[model samples]
Target: MVDAAQKEQLIFVTQKSLRMNRKKHFSESRCLQLFAEILTVDSGLKPAFLFDYCLSNAEQIQEYVQELQQTGLLSENLHILSMQENVLIINLNRIIQHLERALQENGVQVIDVSVHRENPQLAETWVTKQVRAQVDIIWKHLKSQVIQTGESKPGLVTASEIFSSEWNLCTMFGFLLGFPASYWFDFNTSFENCLSMTPLRAFSVSAFCPRITKNLKHRMYSFSVPDILYLDLQSAIKTWQRELQSDFQTQTMFSHLCVSTESVCLSAVML
Candidate 1:
């Protein structure tokens, strides 16, 4: 019922549709692969993962995250906090537990109250206030309801439920990320950081595949240490590198990718 020209047009259209579908599949697969790598790295070393680059839109992220969950790549306790500006994946239990540890270990301070300071009490007061403020911010959002049982117990609250503002989220995340020395400031009082003008040395590690697809040759992981503190933290950084190499070698998904680290000096403000 069709002429030769019409049949050729139909075949061309079918081929084009197939190509488009294939391209879409590759893109979605790449995104998922990247996310899986993040999960694997964070599961062992960090309580949260802050993705600096925008990989996919919100809708796609939700869909991909769900797929990841179904495939057992994402754990039930881990949550996706935000997908707007950047992707924030957090382990709710770990964050809460870390906060408790900070409270217990520091007593009245986490950064330490200097003995040589002109006002040691003043420093202690400020440090305690800042730490408690962060604790309050997290608890305020996780409100408890009284039931007929008459006893109050905490419920499992996701980070997305507890944090509405990005600033507050950042405040909480700073503690849970497991940096050797995390800077803490009261977000309610000020957003300024003590390391504002300092130089930050960023160590970036990536899983590289030379023969991989053009769009996805590298999956990177990076964190920064203040340049002044690098000497004290060099051993910690070495430990991290060793762990990364071990993970890359043991994980079957990363079998094709070789891990490498690159260090560079960056301005603190740029982060």
Candidate 2:
């Protein structure tokens, strides 16, 4: 009983709605692909990562998290430390335990020149002292912040609280994220690092993560270290790669992830 013009208008509207739905679906799926890469945290390859919540709507974020949980991509050990601003800082609740295990198992030598540079006599014991001192400092800082914010427990601290602390935010995150050679500097004197004009290499690991959607492939994590330290950190880097590969083989979420790494020469002052 419908006229030709009326029928044409209805069909056009239906097609437009379908197109809009597809676009939304694609956008959410893309976000999932990138976000799900943080499953590396749960796998113990890394301790934490930052997720950008601004990339998707709240509903989409909820659904993405739900899907990850349902599929075990986001495990019980992993938790969001701060849901502030655009970036959500995700980390393990038992961070100290994780860091201790990573340090012991990977044969990573923790060295902090900042600790022993002032007192050269302490060089021999500095490495051991530095590890415990740094961990204690970070733990105490986090505990105080969590208590003040009432976020959760000592494990669930906020970014804003971390920023308010005396320690450098980037340095703290670098350690928490399990980078072998995190740059250390005196924040009181100046936040500037000595990497100016120095040759640097950007290291990135990427994978075709299909937990959310088959079409998504992108870099999971990236960081830069001084070219000079490449040799010193080579062992740690290899251990990290091996652990990632082990995860790819054993973890259900990382099946077919196809993780790979690339290094490129780059120069930057304020990394």
Candidate 3:
């Protein structure tokens, strides 16, 4: 439940939200910061999962909200989609207040809402300023944490490796800090590439995808090839999406699903 201090910010949620809502101000990382601060403000609340369209389960989100609205858990007028441009904001304070009163009447104790209200302007200021700054700080540190390589390394580094290294860093950070990354860089989601979007990644699949497929298909016969499949960006992204909300597993081989793990795994199998 949300606190009573945030009602003024509800001004942002309007009839305009009845149409398609485009969420411009809050990205996933930004939402993470907002939720994290809320957690800080009230120590008792824990975030479960927040659904947004940018997430992989776009279809599931649609159905879940429809269910909630149909069951009267949510309003039919509620803005269901976060379009990253026009969006609806909820009045957390009032909603919690109503819920608390209803529950108390039914003898179900609820989380204590803070009677002391704070300036809602402060939340606005924090969202506009600090959230971006915090994301920058995290992104900067992640850039540094990547495992460095030299000219002596095997293949010439592709742009994907350089980019996904940050993803790897974020993966490690979330594992260490007990939080998962909410939004990822947009490029990772693309089925195409900067090289004119010529289906270049899929084309590359013909290069090494076969051997790995062969190994997996025939591994039962102990006739596996001694090669590894550096899952292209597409496959890696699909894997990451499936595991998006999962706890970071320290023992999971190639948790980031980048090429380096493919290299290591093949080398180890050969050895």
| Each model's Cα RMSD | 11.1, 10.1, 24.3
* Candidate order (lDDT): 2, 1, 3
Q: Ten consecutive residues with minimal summed lDDT in candidate 3?
A: 217-226
Instruction: Report the C-alpha displacement of residue 122, candidate 1, in angstroms.
Output: 14
Give TM-scores for every candidate, taking all chains together and pairing residue i with residue i.
Answer: 0.50, 0.60, 0.17
Estimate the TM-score for candidate 3.
0.17
Candidate 1 least-lDDT 10 residues: 141-150
Per TM-score, what order, best first? 2, 1, 3
Residue 251's lDDT in candidate 3: 19
Best by TM-score: 2
48-97: candidate 1 lDDT, tens digit per residue: 56654344534444444444454444443445555236556555555445
Candidate 1: TM-score? 0.50
Cα lDDT of model 3 by residue, 1-271, tens digit: 2222222222122111211234443443333233332222122111112322243333333343333333322221221222232121122222233223322333111111111212001123333233334434433433332222122232211111122232323222221121211111123443221222111111101011121122111100011111212232234334433443242232121122212122112211110
User: Number of the top candidate by lDDT?
Assistant: 2
lDDT for each residue of candidate 2 in 1-271, tens digit (9 for 90 to 100):
2235533443333233222343443343434444555555655555666654245433344344444454333444334444223243344444555456554564334433243243111123544455545656655654454455454543222343233354445555666676655655555666555554555566676565444445555565677665666677778767767766665676554434443444554343554
Each candidate's lDDT (Cα)?
Answer: 0.45, 0.49, 0.24
Which stretches of model 3 miss by more than 4 angstroms?
A: 7-194, 197-231, 247-271
Model 2 alpha-carbon drift over 4 Å, by segment: 1-30, 42-45, 53-77, 83-97, 102-132, 137-164, 256-269
